[model samples]
Target: REDPSDAIVLKSGLHLDKPLDILFDTKAGTIGTSSLRRIAQLKQLNPEIKIQDVRGNLNTRLAKLDDKNGDYSALILASAGLKRSDFNGRISHQLRDNWYYAVGQGALAIETRVGDTFTLDLLKPLIDLKTTYECLAERTFMQQLEGGCSVPIGVHTSWNNDNQSLLTLEGIVLSLDGRTKVQNKMTIDLNERLVNANIDDSSCPFNYTDIAINQMSDHIVVNKLRNSAILGYELAQSLTELGAKRILDAIKRQ
Candidate 1:
C-alpha cells in the first residue's frame, strides 16, 4: 500500500452500484448533494420510494430500514461498508452498472508530504499503476468543475479491462432539486500520449511531474498519468458545454 508521491489511489471501487435508494454517506460531511441525483434518478422510475433522514452508523440504519413501521422501505449503502462490518449478508441487491457516484467515491489515497523523496521512493513498489492513473483522471475532473463533497457531482471512471491505458470517464452535475442535470463522457487512449520528450514545457503543461528518474519511477508513467488528467479536463469542459455550469450555478445559489 506504499506508493510514493504526494497522493496516490490506494484503491477505488469503494462505491455501490446504482439501485441505492438514498445517497447514504456516513464518512462525508456533505450528503445533501450526493442524494439528489441518484434519488431523483431512481424515484423517476420508482415513485413509491421516499427519502427520509436517518442518522446513525451502518447497523443502526439497517435496523431502521428493517422496522416495519419505519418510513424507510430501503436504505442505500456502500457494499464496501457492508463487507467491512461483516454484514455482507445484509446486502440483498447491488446496483453496479451505470451507477454514478460521488467523485472519488470508491477511491482511497496514500498521502505524503510533497517532495518527500525518501518516503515516495519507498512506496513505488506497491503502486497499482492503472488504478492510480484512473484516479488522477477522476480527481482532475472533479477539480476542473470545482466539485467537492458538498457539490452534487457524480462520476464514474474505469480503465478498459483488457487495455489499462484506455480510460472512460462519465460525469453528472445536478441541480440541488435534482430536477436538472447535465452529463457527458469521454475516452482517452494513453497510448496516444505525447511521444516527443524534448518538447517545450510551456506548450504542453501537465500536473504530472518527477516520478521516473528522480523518484525511481518510469518516465513514461508520469506521461500516462498526465494523459489521464487531460482526459478529465476535457470531459469537464464537455459537460460544461452541455450546460453543466448552469446546473452548478443554480446549486451554488442554494
Candidate 2:
C-alpha cells in the first residue's frame, strides 16, 4: 500500500500437484468464498465434489485428507499456505490453474500505521511492483463489483505473454451452482495507460506524501499503480455492461 492498511493481498503461489478425485475442506469465513468458487468451477468438469465443514488448522485438515479411512477425496486449500508450510508436495489433481482464483486469493499482506515512516521505509524495499499492481487491480474489481461470499466472483491478473509491460485482467461471475457464467477480460499496456493520464499531485489516491512520492522514482511507481487500479474499474464496467451485474444480483437475491 502506498499509505497503509494493505501493503499486500493474497497472491497465487505454488501448490501441490495432488490429483482431484475427491473434495473436502477446513471450513472458515471469507476464505471459504474462494473454496465455493473452486467447487463451483471444478464441479463442471468432474462429478459432484463433496463439501463438508471440517474443523482444524492446516495440519488437522491435511491429516483428514490423508486419512486412509477418511471419505474425503480432496481438500480445498490455499496454495500459498501449503507452500509456506512446506507441504506443497502433497498437492495433486490441481484445480487452481485450470480457472481463475478469487480476487486476491493467496495474497500476502503487510500492514502498518498510516503515517509510520519508519515502518514504511523498512517495508518499501520488499514490495514487488508487479505483484503490487496485480493485487491492486484485483482489489479494484472485487470492490467495484461489490462481490462477496454470496456472489462468488473470480478474477485473474497476469502480464502479457509477448510484452512484459502489458497486463491483462480477466473476471468471471458464476452462479453458485456453476450453471450460469459471464466472463470478460481487458488488456492494457501498463506503461501506455499513463501516457495521456493527468499526472498531477492528485494522480495517486493512496499517495504517501513522505514515503511513496517523496522521490521522483517513487512518484512514478505510484503513478503506475494508480493506472493499474483503473484497469480493474474499467474491467468492472465492461462486466456490468455484459450482464455480470444481473448474474450477481440474482445470486444475491437467492
The candidate scoring highest on lDDT is 2
**Error at 223, model 1, angstroms:** 1.1
RMSD of each: 8.2, 7.3
- How many backbone clashes does every candidate have? 5, 18
State the lDDT of candidate 2 residue by residue for 1-254, as single tens digits: 22111011111232324333223222211111235666566555443544555568878776765565655545566666666778766545345444777666666667667657687677766866776777777877777788865566888777877887788899888777777777888887767545424323354434411124223356666566767777877888888888888988887788
Q: Candidate 1: how many backbone clashes?
A: 5
Candidate 2, residue 237: lDDT: 84
lDDT of 1 by residue, 153-189 (tens): 7777766899877889888887655567788888888
lDDT of 2: 0.60
lDDT of 2 at 88: 61
Best by TM-score: 2
Per-model TM-score, in order, reads: 0.74, 0.76
Alpha carbon RMSD to native, model 1: 8.2
